[model samples]
Target: MVLVQNTNWNNAAKALKNISTATNFQLDKILNLSDKELEKLVMPSGYYHNKAKTVRNVLGMYQTSFSELKKLDTDTLREKLLAIKGVGEETADVMLLYLFNRPVFVADNYTRKFFSKYFKQKFTYASLRKNIMKNFAFTVKDAQEFHALLDVYGKQNK
Candidate 1:
């Protein structure tokens, strides 16, 4: 669910460490900050400044309200995540499918490209996701495995 390409994690950690060096706040405190506060805390990370605020707010809301995010039903959690700023259908679907073990097909550029080439028709994200779910054997485990296999095949072919 936390799809950091190894190098990105190191870079992000280093940046966070630099920010922490100046601010006395701990990681937990920073993470729990309100949306506006978080926007100020994580400044100038390109477009991530606004995104960080949304992420923090959503996380804080879930932490305070749910106390255990993993316990929420996938559909409920997806809807909740979608309500947060900066979290669109793709992000919500990623959290539900990857993080919450829901049966969902994440329609990104790669998915769209592959499907379009195979089907010879342009497909929107909603339509593509629905097509996969409706046509394939719909199960969380199966969706996960199929997605993984598709990624592997894509990489190999590339």
Candidate 2:
């Protein structure tokens, strides 16, 4: 979901899928790629240099395969990723929701402005997310998808 974070230019998902397809969705394959190679692959996503670095850095820490990554619990994985420099609340939440299969809602700037206006409630990354989970965590995947769909709607309406 690092790709989701960098979707400012072009179609971000396509750019990311291109890189994933080139590397065959393998962590080690992507890690073996030099910075320049990864940068070029991600150039269409915008902020190629920094986004490439963030991807490499995250993959560097997670050198093992996805099967191994699947063994970790959501909180442990979230804690580890959050400790990384490039991972923020939204990015970490994305990793937790999408990658770790946790029921986390990624609260972006859109979430804040939209929720504040509509719900008449102030929010921070922490508080808004807490309330979202409190209200929507009736089931795991459902809650995760709700967040994703909400984000897409917010972005489109903006």
Candidate 3:
């Protein structure tokens, strides 16, 4: 969520690297940091304060029920994630696909634009997600690659 929310990819990557290094990529260590420290760590990403809060909030949720969340069906898991602040549909789908290894397409703005250009159709987030899931048969990896490619295409076109 922090990585793609309003910030450019390079800035987000730098912020993520900084946070990972400081926390040794450990969730507990990150959670242990004071909010100001967490905000400083993610400064490069911009919107550090809100991003820090979001990171804390989502990780707090994970720290408590990660295993239980993983066991949930995709729909239930998506709903649970969506309920968290700062987790939009794209971020929720991202966690479902990458973290949980669920087969889901992230119909983010990039994907929406890609489809609009090539398919000559404009689709809302839910509509495109539903259309892709219903019409295409993709494994988790395939969906990941497709979303990445769409992001790459969108970036290049921009």
Best candidate according to lDDT: 3
- Across 1-158, the per-residue lDDT of candidate 1 in tens digits comes to 22221123354564465447645545477675665665554443434565566556655665576546568876688778778776777777877777677788877656777788889999998899878767765698877777777656655654
Q: Which regions of candidate 3 deviate over 4 angstroms?
A: none
**Weakest 10 consecutive residues of candidate 2 by summed lDDT:** 1-10
In model 3, pairs of residues that clash are: none
Ranking by lDDT: 3, 2, 1
- Candidate 2: tens digits of C-alpha lDDT, residues 71-149: 7787777777888777788888877776677776777877777888898978998999778777664456886767767
Query: Against the unseen true structure, what C-alpha lDDT does each candidate score?
Result: 0.65, 0.76, 0.88
**Best-first order by TM-score:** 3, 2, 1
Best model per TM-score: 3
Candidate 3 lDDT tens digits, 1-158: 65667778899999988987898879999999999999999999888888888899899998998999999998999999999988888889999988888989899888899888889988999999998888767899998898899989989997
Our model 2 lands, by Cα RMSD against the true structure, at 2.7
Question: What lDDT is reached at residue 63 by model 1?
Answer: 59
Worst 10-residue lDDT window, candidate 3:
1-10
Please provide TM-scores, in order, for all candidate models, with all chains considered together: 0.65, 0.79, 0.92
Residue 119 of model 1, lDDT score? 90
Off by over 4 Å in 1: 1-27, 32-46, 66-74, 153-158
Q: Which residue pairs in candidate 1 collide?
A: none
